[model samples]
Target: MKVLLKGTSLLLLILAGTVMGCKSPENASNFPKRPNILFAIADDQSFPHAGAYGFAEIKTPAFDKVAKDGVLFNNAFVAAPQCSPSRAAILTGKNIWQLEEAGTHASSFPKKLNVFTDMLEDAGYQLGYTGKAWGPGNWKIAGWDRNPVGPAYNEKELTTVPSTGINKRDYFGNFSHFLEKRATGKPFFFWYGGHEPHRVYEPGSGAKAGKRFKNVQLPGFLPDDSVTRNDVIDYAFEIEYFDAHLLKMLKLLEEKGELANTVVVVTADNGMPFPYAKANLQEYGTHVPLAISWPDQIKSSKKVDDLVSMIDLAPTFLEIAGIKSAPVMTGQSIVPVLFSKGGENTSKRNYVLTGRERHTHARPDNLGYPARAIRTKEYLYVKNYKPERWPVGDPVPPNDENNKRAQTEGFKTLFPGYHDIDGSPSKTFMMKHQHEESVNRLFKNAFEKRPEAQLFDIQNDPECLYDLSGNTEYSDICADLRNKLDQELTKQGDPRMFGSDIFDSYPRYSPMRNFQGFNARGQYNPAYAD
Candidate 1:
């Protein structure tokens, strides 16, 4: 049986040695004893960028070394493309929809939920985190005592950084700080959340670091120009910078003689912070780099191509640590896949589902762009709840005085829509060159209005430039995927399936934007007051 609770009582499980208030996983441990967990997650990074993933631009020696020592995952994905929701999934072992307020960007974390960190702590594993945890949101309002990710070791700070907007927190020093505070001779679970490679890079930082532009390769969606290549190089510089700290942490673990017993996982929260990348649920937005190294338990120098979700990491960690997961957790553990000696036997993990809502309050009335997706090995199907709404966000929001006006009556167009896209050098180039034929394609792809239903063959079109949903040749395939998605959502009791409309009604907790209402398609509607 599983432990299920609701309301304020859910947070009362501060008692030790309990597994979601259910039976302990120690009863089911047939393998060796539990291992220490050191999860290192990067902020705003995408797949095919790590050196281990064969991306030529980035140099991730630390990530590559981890892959060499353990298993490298080629197809790793997070539940949402945004930071708050993606990290919420990692903590709860559930999808975005299951998390209520936490499913949206910068919203309140629901205190009723049971996260893996809490479970591990109750099971007697010492836990703490440094750098960014589950964020861009207010965790205190939810009634919990601390951030859902864990306690903070952010007392220490550093000044030297390679670029602007990169986190200056000494992550390696914090990890060492966490080690000093733990109880003697006990298993530990430490989260090293690196705030790197998100956005706001120093101009020409890559060139400043002596990185050659020839090694940069732009994705198919972006233009093959010098600016885009240089932009990507700057991103690479951040990746390498982030990796450098992990290298030092690995050395520290080795020095402590805990390297063999530590389950080291290195990944990211979401995709790159760029237009048509981070906020959108596209291939690049959701696909992330993953490398897990545990020299004691799993095989070395291997690769696993199984479709795995970031949420699944919670259950995997819980299971390995001899703690049972909460019943609300939908993510399946990858322990079996890890111990299977690097074989393609993951028949149950055929689908990788993800979705997003309201990543930023860029639209009038704090409206969210709701979307759900189901990705199989062959194709990817998407269902947009509101096709009439701008996919990125409204071009401009209402003014401070008029922000509280009716949301859907009407408005005037200001700038081109797609404010959900992050501010970046590559985006600046596309916006500046929209008049040219070669660059307009790039702008349209990022700012265009998509249909209610979208389908893409991920194998052939990982960029998702062409929509195969309406094509007659793929009608049956589209219908099958739709049916599959609806059935799964229905089984999971998703509010969307029940016509609940809860997602839209949920209060937008992020600070509202006041940019003046735009181009007559939408109107003013303030989300919520502070």
Candidate 2:
């Protein structure tokens, strides 16, 4: 009886040890088991707008929290100033120039190119996206039956609202649904693309909501007036709205007990939609805000000043998911900077590059004005391949008699009417001063016919107000940047850098030409002549 009792006691002790071993904390810092990824992208947002980035007028509590908890990169940029190309680069981890079809705006993406989402899904992770995804273009050719992100929502689900009269589809409700449907014990990837702060802002919305124009700081390139101030305020309102949705999404994640394990990255597709900002390769055009948070992994808040591009995002996402990247991906993973115990490295890239193809339907034969640029920490060198073409589409007089009459009567109107059209006070101011000597000088300074090469000192002139390309003092800087750009172009396999003879060898893809209005009948409208 004593021997039997002792054996029973030993069995109980072994069972207790096994139970305790199962309860031990999972060492998630190692490989194989990956954390979930949540990438939230905003449309047409600029740098320094969120409170985390130092914008006092706008309240972005969620973004600020992410920055406060993790890492905020001060020098993050996009490969292209436009949406399609930038998004393509982020997904494929390839340079825009290398993704020929995907390189152009509204162009059809080829099926041959592999996306990070596909790799992640293949690696046993559930992948989906809510709201805007790869494009305003067709993804069918890319073998996607539905949106690359996922399936669309029902009509009733789509028509709901967060606040009274405000669309809920534009917020986190859809994102919440996406998270709920994700399978248990499996990781998920979601892309929350918010279509806020793009354009056609509600007039007086900011002032009505108690936002004061007096607190607004005018950019040097824009005219300082009530009209411009009000325009800026409207922009602020939309940015705040976007932030509100982000806050709700964060709450949802927390409630699900997944906040600690999930990696959240917040950023924008490109710069603002203002003139000379969006669709241009300037600092204000390509520079964007980036904030990342991972409570279970990243323990402290920090700021990194390395020159990181949107293209790096794909590789970083793949690295975090423990997926191997393809050799074609030119972008390097930023995981080392985020997860390393040592201090973050800011000496990664010596320069960043961007370019623009087509913007609006302004040129004849649906031609686009091509320009490429290289931006260093202190200097920006641009090469305008086509100088004679109008940087902004060619001017087209108002077709409607009432619109023409309004312009004649001194009311404001944006010309060409192809891209943006609004009767604003700034438009009136621009019209009044369109031909004045001082205004002409400013216009020349901002946008004018340029030589093949242009350079600017960004430190002294943040708005790119002056061109120091001709200045002898900075001649060495220009030569150095030019040589660096040439080397990079060669490395990237761009035919343009090789010679004009090889330009024809590279396949040509039209940038948003069909969507902008290139007639399929091949007929020309002489009335729209420049």
Candidate 3:
């Protein structure tokens, strides 16, 4: 009886050990043995454009599928309004102001900064990017032998008319090739940057392709005309085209049996290119779509409205890959939000900040309108660092014969029926009017001087049509936001907020303005008069 009892005890102990071994702490990580990453970025896509974001005009099945299966961030914002600075922020996980040249449009990224690709490569992961990657500038000085995407990635060739050629690098095709070349067991990260939906679109590309202009929804700032509608349709056509390629990439991943383990992130660098959109610091300008998917690990689909920024992407990627982020990265990882419990509170910030240094080469001395903004749920407060400079840029007077002739002819063709048109016909019509009153107001709205501080009630004025800076009702909120922003700037060691003379001491570098030997008008005028 004693022997039998001892045997039974041993058997029970073996069973318990087996159960404990099967449910180890290692299983809690839920990380794949070797998971792949695919980060697809669009050139100029704004929020609510993708079908997943609730826009019916364009169908983005691949992006929608990811959102349906994973998580969608409804309030993700980019660090800057333009392409280069915004992309730089995503790469470095630092605000644009922290990066010197990389903060400006068409500027060369400094070699010293640590990018995510470098961190991943150091962590024993294969990294390569196809299509646009840290571009519109010379990359050699940035310590890159090739594009920052990777050394193995293929270059995409341009396809356009002789005079107006477009960069037609097949981003999807390159991504497929990158996946095929990766070792069977090694994980790889690929950046699929699509240069679509940007400006200089092919006229009637939408109509000829069966897209109806009537289906387009015009923004309140733009006129409700065929030209504007057609422009939007053309924009949608490119978006659809981008989606088609994205679908192809997803199929390739699935066929390779890497779909379940792969983490796919779909987003854009900045807002859509429009009159009051792309270059500005409005909600529509900095607000972008962000969706992520990881089927093997992520259990449910969730829509998060927490305030997130493009700067957070780097840290998140590193954390997922079991790699530590560098010390200088200002962004915090959002991994908790991704795999949070139902009742988990994972909001990192109550507000998001964005700014700009230089955009286009339209200003005197190539000086851009330096503005910083802080956006909360109900309000947006902007501080124009240089109110004396043009808000848009210095405007070239229409005194030249050709400009004058174009102005006269454009006005005549725009308003043919009215002998005396009162109250500017529309945005397009006002563009042709060269009169001082008409021109002054347009410039004031677009390029003239602005106040040092501006406030907008984004809830009511989504387009930021009215300025409530002078309103006493919002004065307290404005002051609080301003104080918060100043504290942040001080923490970041910005000289402007610290009241230092660094602004006057620093040398100005013109990347977008003079890098390509083009003048403010985008013409190849060889006069170095500036």
Question: Which prediction has the highest TM-score against the true structure?
Answer: 1
Candidate 3 wrongly placed segments (more than 4 Å): 1-34, 155-166, 341-345, 400-430, 433-448, 498-530
Q: RMSDs, each prediction?
A: 6.0, 14.9, 14.8
lDDT of 2: 0.67
What C-alpha lDDT values do all the predictions have? 0.79, 0.67, 0.68
**Model number with the top lDDT:** 1
Worst 10 residues of 2 by lDDT: 18-27
Query: Please, what are the lDDT tens digits per residue for candidate 1 over residues 1-530?
Result: 11133332233222211123443332244557778999999998998889988887788989998999888888889999999999998998888877777888887788877888988888889989998999988788769899998889998888787777678898888989899998998899999888888888887899888888877777888877888888888888998988999999898889989998899999999999877889888888999999988988765677988999998898788888876534445787888777667768562688989999877766665668889999887888999888988898765433433444423333222244456887777887887787788878777778777899999899999888888988999999989888998877665555566544455545545545554432222222222211
Q: Output the worst ten-in-a-row residue range by lDDT, candidate 1.
A: 521-530
Cα-based RMSD of candidate 3: 14.8
| Ranking of candidates on TM-score, top first | 1, 2, 3
TM-score of every candidate relative to the true structure: 0.89, 0.83, 0.81
Q: In candidate 2, list every pair of residues with a backbone clash.
A: none
Positional deviation of 283 in candidate 1, in angstroms? 0.2
For TM-score, candidate 1 versus 2, the one ahead is 1
What is the number of backbone collisions in each predicted candidate, taken in the order shown?
Answer: 10, 0, 0
Model 3: per-residue Cα lDDT over 1-530, one tens digit each: 00111243334423322111211111123354646789888888888788987786788998998998899988888998888889888988878767655776765666766788877788778888876777655556557776655654655454542112134676766787777677768888888887777666777777877878898766665556677687777777788877777889988889978899899999998887765567678777788889999988887998987788998988788778877434446676778778875334475678988987667654434446677899987888989898886665544443534334535543222122111111122333435543456344433454346688889887898767677888899899889999998877656644345342222212223322222122333212223211
